[model samples]
Target: MDAPAERLQAADAELQEIDERIAEIGRQNLDAVADAYKEFSAVLDRYEDRATDRDDFQGYIEFREQMAEVLGSIPDDLPHRDAFTEADDELTTGVTSVLKHANFDRARSQLEPAREYAELRSREQDVQGTYRDARSALQKEQSTLETERNELERLKRLGEADLDAPVSLLREPIEAYNDAVAEAFDSFTHAASARAVLDLVAETTAYPLVEYRPPPENLHEYVHESAVGEESLSRLLDLAGYSSSKLDHYVENPQAFRSNVATNQSYLSGLSATPLQVSWPPVASDALGWHMRERIAVVGRFATDEVVALARAVRDLGLRDDYERLRTSATARESLSETDRTRLRAGEIERDLTTHRASLDSVREILATYPPLGRR
Candidate 1:
C-alpha cells in the first residue's frame, strides 16, 4: 500500500480499537459514569473558591449537599460504585468548618474511574478526527495520481514513435507551402484595402483552428461604412501618423480617423498570417485534410494563385498513407527532450506509470473498505 493508504489503515485500526474498548465497558454504563461525573465536577468547581478556607460558610453547606445528591442519583447497580462512595467519603470531614484543596484533590483521585470512562469517548472522537484527515489526504493523492497518469501516457505515446521515419518528407512540403502563403498574405495585406483584409479574417470564424481575434465592433463598422475603407491598411496606418493639419488634407474628418482607426493602431499592426499556417507537428490526417480544405477557400479569396496552389499541395500531402507516420515522428522530435528520451529508452516511464496506478488502486481500496465514522 502507498503511504496514504497505510496511514488510513493505521487510523482505521486505532478507531476500531477505541470502539471495541467503548463496547466492552458497555455504552450505557459509560454514559452513566460520564453524567454522574459531570454533576460531580460541577459541584466541586462551583464551591471550590467560596467554600474553601471558610471563605463562605453557606457555600460550604451548599457544596456538601450537592455532592451528596450527586452520589445519591447514581444507580445502585452502576459499575464502579465504590469510586463514587470513596469520592463522597473523601469530602466528608466530621464537624470540619472548612474544606481545603487537599480534600478536593483526594476526592478527585477517588473519582478517577468515572474520569477514565468519560475520557474514553473523547479519545474515540480524537481517533475519528484522525481517520477523517487521513481519508481527505488519500482523496487528494488519488486526484494527483490521475493527472500524473495522463501526462505519463502522453510521454509514452511519444516514446513509441518510429524516430527513423523521414519526417522531412512531410515537413519540407508543409514548410514550403507555409512560407509561400505567409509571404503572399503579407503582400495581400499591403495591397488590399483594410476593409477587404479584415473582412477575409472575419470569415475564418467558422474554422476553429484558424484562430483570429474578431475585429473590434466599432473598428469593423468604421472600415465597412467610411469612405476611407477603400485605402490599403499600410497606407492608412502611415496616414494616421500625420499631423492633424496634414491629416485633414488627406481625409475629411481627422478626429473621426483618430477615434475609429488611429486608436486601434496596435490591433491593426498585430494582424498576421501566422494562424493561417499549419503547425510543424501537424494534426491527424483527417483533421488536417478538413482544415486545409477550409483554408484553401479562405486563402484563395485574397492570396496570389501561386500561394493558393501551395495550400492545395499541403492538402494533397495529408491524403498520403505515409503522412500519419511522418507526422507522429515529427511530433516526437519536436516535443521530447534529452531527459525524456533517456527515461523512455530505459523503460523508467513505464515503471513509474505502473507504480502510480498501483498507489491509486491501493488508496481507492482503503477508502472503500473504511468509510467515515458517523454518529454512533
Candidate 2:
C-alpha cells in the first residue's frame, strides 16, 4: 500500500476501535441504570407490603370492637346477652394491656376509675352509682383507642407517601439521554464519519461530558481522572501525551500518543463506576445536587486543542485531516443556528466542565460506606 493509503487504512482502523470502545462503555452504563431501577423497585415493594399489613390488622380490630358494643346495647332478656357479657370487658382488657406496656402511667390512671366502679358493685352500695361510674370509664377508654388508632393511620400514610416520585424523575431524563445517543451512534462509522459527529458535538457550546479514563497512577497503574483539577495538565506532562509516565518519543511522531487497548478499558471501568467524576450538570449546589447525582454515564468532552491532538495522530500519518482542528468554515458555521454560534464563542461547555467541584465533593460523603456500585 502507498503511504497515503496506509495512513487512511490506519485511520479507518483506529477510528473504528475508538468508536467501539466508547459505545461499549455506554452499554455498561445503561446496564448499571437498569440494575439501579430494579434495586429501587425492590425497596419500595417491601415498604408497601409492610404498610398494607398494618392497615388490614387495624381494620379487623376496629370491626370486632364495634360488634361487641352493638351486642351490649341489647336488654338482658335477649338470647345474646350472655355472650355479650362474656366479651364485654375483653376488648377493654386488651387495650389496657397494650397501654400498660406502651405507656404505663396513663394505663394506671385509667384503671383507677374503672376499679372504683367494680368495688362499688361488690359492696352493693347503690347499684345506680356503679352503673354511672362504669359508663364514664367506658367513655375514657374509647377516647384512648381513637387517639392510638389515628396515630397509627397517620404513620401508615406517611410511609406510603410519594417516595417513588423522585426516583422516577431522576431516571426518566437519563433514559431519554441514552436513547438519543443510541440513535446518533447508528451513523458513526469511520474516522471521517466520526469527525462529522465530533463537529456536531463541538458546535454545542454547552454539553455534558463524563470525564472517563482517569489517568494511571504511574504508567503501570491508573491514577486520577485526566479532566480533574491539574490532572489534564499532568497528562500533557506524561512525555508522550497519553498520560503514560514514560518518556516522550512522540512530539514529532503521532503514533506514540495512542496507548494499548487494555489500559484504556481498565481506566474507563473505574471512572464510569462513579458519576461524580464526570463533567456535567455544571455546578453542584442544592438546586442542582439531586438531579446531578442521577447521571449514569456521560461521554468525555474534548476542547479544540485536544481534538486536534487526536486528529494529529492521523493527519501526520500523511494527508492533512482538516476535520481534527474543528471546522469553522462558513459551511460548518451555517450548519448551526445563531444561538449555538453565540454559545460556542462564550465557551459555556468548557466553563461548566470546571464549575461543579463542590457538587462532586458532596457525593463523595455518601459513597464512603455504601458504594453505589456495590463491591466493585
Candidate 3:
C-alpha cells in the first residue's frame, strides 16, 4: 500500500474512536440528567406528603377540641349531677385522709389546688393530652421526612456530578459544545450583567433608575395584590436573553419566590415601622450577598473562563446606592435618642456583617472547587 493511503486509514480509525467515545458520553449525560430530575421529583413528593400530614393533624386537633368544648358545655342531667356529687365527696374524703397522714403544709399545698381546679381543668387536660399525642406523631413523621430529604439531596448531588461526567470522557467534544453554547448565550448573559451593573452604579451614584419600596404590611394581601414582582423578574430575565420558554417557566411562576420574599419581609418587618428606624441594611446586604453567592455557584457548576470573567465584573461593580443609604441610616441611628432604634440598627449591622462574611466565604468555596482557569 502507498504511504499516503496508510496514513489516511490510520487518521480515519482515530476519528472513529473519538466519535464513539463522544456518543457514549452523550448517552450517559442524558441518563444522568433524567435521573437527577427523577430524584428531585421524588423529594418534592415527599415534601408535599409531609406538609399534608401536618395540615391534617392540625385540623384534626382543632375539630377534636371544638367538639370536646361543645360536649363539656352541655348541662348535666339529675343522674349525672348526683354521680358528680358522689365523686366529689369521695375526693374530699381522700384529700382529708392525705392531709392527716402527710406533712400538713405539703399536703395542703398539693391537694387544695387539685380540689379547687379539677372541675375547671379536667376537659382542658384531656384535650391537651390528645394534642400532645398528635404533636408527637407529627414529630416522628417530620423526622422521617427530614431523613428522606437529606438522602434525596445527597442522591441529587450525586446525580449532578453524574450529569457532568460526560465532559471528562469527551473533553474535547464537550469543550466544543461549551463554545457553541457560549456563543449562543454570550450576548444575553453579558447584556444582563451589564444592565445589572448599570442599575447598581446608577443607584449608588444617586441617579437611581429604580426606587426601593417596602413590601406591604399584610403579607397575604401583598401576595394577592398582583404579579408585579413576578412580571418584573420575567422582564429582567428576558432582557438578559433567556429565550428558552422552558427555562423561563419557573421565572414566570412568581409564587416560587413568594415564600422567599415573605420570609425576608417578615425579618425586615420586625423592626419599627418608622422609615428611619426600620433599618434596611440587612436587606441591602443580603441582596448583594445572595447575588454574589449565586454567581459563585454558577462558576462552580460551569467552571469556565467566561464565568470567572463575569465574577470579576460583578466584584468590580461595588455596593448599590440603596445599600449605602441603609448604611448611612444605620450609622445615624447610633446617635438617635431612642435606645430601641439604636439597638435595632446595631442588630441589623451585626446580621448584615455576618451574612456578608458568609457570602464571601461561599465565593471562596467556589474558587476552591474551580480555581480560575489558569491558576496552579
Candidate 4:
C-alpha cells in the first residue's frame, strides 16, 4: 500500500477503538445516570444561594423537593446508583446548615462514572471526523497514480521492438535521398525565379507529412503579379536593401517592393528543400511511401536526373518484406534513452506497473468501506 492508504488504515483502527468504548459505556446504563446528574446539578444552581444559612427559608423546602424528584427518576437497574444517592444525601444534611462550595465539589466527585460516559461519546465524534479526512486524502492519491501507470505501459510497448534488426537498410537510402535533394533544391532556389520556387512549395500542401508553412497571402500575390517576381529570391532580397531612388533602377516600382518583398524578407529567405527531406527515424512504411510519391513529383520539376533517381530509390524501400520490422527497430533505437534500456533489462518497468495496480485496488477497497460521508 502507498502512504495515503497506510494513513487511512491507521485512522480506521483508532475510530473502531473509540466506537467499542462508547458501546461498552452504553451497556452499563451510565448514559441514563448522566441525565439524572444533569437534573440534580441544575437544581443546586437554582436554590443554593437562597437556601444556604436559611437566607430564604421557603427556598430550602423547594431545594429538598427537587433533589428528591431527581433521585427518584433514576432506574433501579442503572449503574452508579449509589453515587447519585450519596451526592443527594450530602446536599440535604440539615435544613438551616451552612452550605459551602466544598460540599458541591465532593458531590460531583462521587458521580465520576456518569461524567466519564459523556466524555467518551465526545471523543468518538472527534475520531470519526479524522477517519473521513484520511479517506479523502487516499482518493486524491489514486487519481495521480493512474496517469503515471499509463505512461509506463507506453514505454513497455516501445521496449518490445527488436533492437538488433538491420535498420541501416532503411536509413541508408533515406539519408542519401535527403542529402541529394537538399543540395539540388538549394541550387534551384538560388538560380530559379521566386515564382517557380513558390509554385513548387504550393504543390506540397496536399501532402500532410510534408510540413511546409504556406506562403503569406500578400507575399504570394506580390511574387506572381509583380515583374520583380522574375528575379531570383536572392537577388530580390538584395534589391530590397537599396535606398528608394537607387531601388527604382533595379525594379519597376520600388515602393511596391518595400511593402511586399522587404516587409516579408524573413519568409522568402527561410524557404528551402528542408521540408522535402525524410526524417532519420522514418515513419511507417505506408506513410513514407505516400510522402515519397509526392516528393518525387515536386522535386522532379527542376532537380537533376541524379537527384530524381535517389528519390525513386527511397520510394521503393516500402516494397521490401522487412520494411515494417526495420522501421519499428529504428524508432526504438532513436527514441529510448540509456536509463530506459537499463530499466527494461532489469525488469523494473513490469515491477512498477504491478505495484501501482495493487495500490489502486487497495485504495478502492477502503473507499467502498468508508464511503467518505463526512469528509473533512
Best by lDDT: 1
**Candidate 1, residues 1-376: lDDT per residue as tens digits?**
6666677788788877877888899988988988888788888888888768575888888887888788889998998888889888877875465678888899889989889988887787787787788888888988998899888888999899999999988888789889988888889889999999889888889877788888888888998888898899888889879999899988878898899999998888888888889888989999988889888888888887888888888888888989888888899999999999999999999999998888778777777887766732
Candidate 3 shows a clash count of 1
**Model 4: how far is 276 from its true place, Å?**
1.1
Q: List per-prediction Cα lDDT, in the order shown.
A: 0.85, 0.34, 0.36, 0.80
- Candidates in order: C-alpha RMSD to true structure: 6.4, 32.2, 32.3, 12.0
Q: Considering only N, C-alpha and C atoms within 3 Å, which residue pairs clash in candidate 3? A: 204-321
> In candidate 4, what are the lDDT values of residues 140-237, reduced to their tens digit?
87787788788778678778988899988999998999899889988888899988888777777877677788888788888999988988878888
Worst 10 residues of 3 by lDDT: 271-280
How far in Å is the alpha carbon of 59 misplaced in model 2? 92
Question: For model 2, how does the per-residue alpha-carbon lDDT over 1-376 read when each residue is reduced to its tens digit?
Answer: 2232233334444544544643754544433333333332233233333322434565435544554445444455532234334433333455423312222233233334333333333333333333334333434444554555454343333333333233322233334444443332332212222223333333332324332333443332222222111233223334333543333333332332344323344342232223322122222223233323222212223223333333223223222243212222322333445654455457643343333333333333323322222241
lDDT of 3: 0.36
Q: What is the lDDT of residue 47 in candidate 2?
A: 32
Candidate 1: C-alpha lDDT: 0.85
Q: How accurate is candidate 4 locally (lDDT)?
A: 0.80
Winner by TM-score between candidate 4 and candidate 1: 1
What TM-score, computed on C-alpha atoms, does each candidate reach?
Answer: 0.67, 0.18, 0.19, 0.57
lDDT of 3 at 67: 30
Q: Candidate 3: which stretches are off by over 4 Å?
A: 1-124, 127-138, 145-167, 170-175, 188-376
